[model samples]
Target: MAYTLYYWPLPFRGIFIELLLAEAGQPFEKKSPSSIYPDHRFDRPLPGMAPPYLVEKGGLQIAQMPAIATHLAERHGLMPSGAEARAAATKAILDANDVLEEISQNGGVQMWEEESWGEFRAERLATWMRIFEETYQHHGGPFMLGEEITLADIAALGLWAPMIHALPPLEEDLKRHAPQVSALLGRLAQRPGLEAFLTAQRARDGQGYCGGEIEASLREVLGLKAEG
Candidate 1:
């Protein structure tokens, strides 16, 4: 089956699916809509007005990060087997998405800069981290679900990783207070497949976050080398 991912190639919302595919030990084609549309031309069909969409074999197209993630996990057996466990994992992914939406509405560029933006950003980040911390602690550390990694873990980690570019302080915060999450990231960093993908991405995108210092840190933490 040919798996084609259509996104802006920013690793923003799309990286979640990318990480899932990486951890699944599968190779898929990444199609960047922004790059194709930059010259005011089209190379493929647009998935509605949204990005980070996926088109599978038989012309099956799906959009939304959380929806795509859940679909992939269930289809590929990356999700939990037990019905209850599966429900919990799905709920956790949606919860994470809710937090992300809050951030996008308040902290993202959706609204003009205001004093509340700073407060909202901090509060929401802390809330999300705390949620993960509790889940990690309850699940017995290392991963969100359990010792065996699942889609929930990948979903949380993938969604959170790219956000580090927007909020550089989060790395320090996670390191200081949420050592478990940091440790989980360390484990994921050791995956050679993920390492290769991240290395190529950093090389092509350059160091630093947002196309600057956080990007370097991301590469370093992910065990990726800088570009020439």
Candidate 2:
């Protein structure tokens, strides 16, 4: 199946869809937002504000990360069979999306202040970590939904791995508060296709998380050198 993904140059939300395609061994083309927005934005197959838009081989288009993820997961056999399981997987995907929004401070709407960032790291962030950790523990898993890996596992990986990769200090927080979640990330990283994709992604992007002044503020708070 031929697929085209439209997103920003940075990984951010698009990485989830990319990882899913990679894990499924599906080949896809990526188009940048620059190529789509303000020109074909409203007239595109699926009209949407902002990107992470997905267009299929047959000219079907989908917008929003979770919706695109669900479509791909269903098509690629990444979603589970049972209704409850599917619902759970969907919940996981949404949860991952929520985490992304939280970390990005609602799509980088406001810069992260040190005090606020500290509070988030200590409280809100820790709560999210525990939520994942507890969910993993409850399922008794090497994966999020237990024995078999699903899009949920991939979601977890997409959410945390890039954050930890871009901000190394947060790795310790994840390891401390959510060891199983950390372990799950380790297992997902070991997948040959996913690992290769991640390597190439790192080469291409290089620790650039949600770009702009908000990201600059994040780096400052973390004492990280601004991306060069």
Candidate 3:
């Protein structure tokens, strides 16, 4: 049951794989950017393009966050069992990705402006969160897909961690506009496996996800000072 995960040292996209493994209660070895050897390069072109890959028994390799996450979830039965639930889970993941894209702003340049953040807080943020909330309520709460944990829950949880980490200001807004999602922050943290990983994650790296390169740029664009 040994497995290996590869990703950049930062928690950004890599953390999603970790969340899934943790939720499954599966043990795995993780390799970060600093850990990979230079000669690890292939003599020929390889199948993969970037980090956030996973390796399993029989030398099976999986790349891309979505495929890796879906494979792991389906294999571990963390994916929804019912068709309707599965569809909802898929949609939930898409919604999460869209939010990630908007917030991340691609290539680590968050072009956040006062007006942009204001409009997002007023318009986009609540709408996206409400989408997740409705699905959670429809599935009957506690988990995104009812009693069973699904990839969507892991996806949503992973997405929230980075956003909260990068911007503390959003915390107050989240509680006010998306209370259900805010409540989930506590619920997901209490999961035994996820709890251990979070404790470890907090301990291991002082560096924030996406780091100051993006954070500084975002702060500048947002018209914040050296410290925010």
The candidate scoring highest on lDDT is 2
lDDT (tens digit, per residue) of candidate 3 on 88-120: 777766676667666656655656666776787
The candidate scoring highest on TM-score is 2
Provide the lDDT at 180 for model 3: 74
Candidate 3 Cα errors over 4 Å, as ranges: 33-46, 219-228
| Whole-structure CA lDDT of model 1 | 0.66
Q: Score candidate 2 by lDDT.
A: 0.88
Summarize candidate 2's per-residue lDDT along 33-89 as a digit string, tens digits.
777776777777667777789989876786789999998899898998889778888
Residue 90, candidate 3: how far off, in angstroms?
A: 2.4
Question: How large is the C-alpha RMSD of every model relative to the true structure?
Answer: 5.8, 1.3, 3.3
**Model 1 agreement with the true structure over 24-129: per-residue lDDT tens digits:** 8777888776654444334445434456678887766766678888988887767987887787788777876676656555234444244545575467657777
Superposition error at 40 for model 1 (Å): 13
Q: Worst 10-residue stretch by lDDT in candidate 1?
A: 206-215
- Which regions of candidate 2 are displaced past 4 Å? none
Order of the predicted models by lDDT, top scorer first: 2, 3, 1
TM-score of candidate 3 versus the correct structure, residues matched by position:
0.83
List lDDT for all candidates, in order.
0.66, 0.88, 0.71
Better of 1 and 3 by lDDT: 3
Give, for candidate 2, the lowest lDDT window spanning 10 residues: 38-47
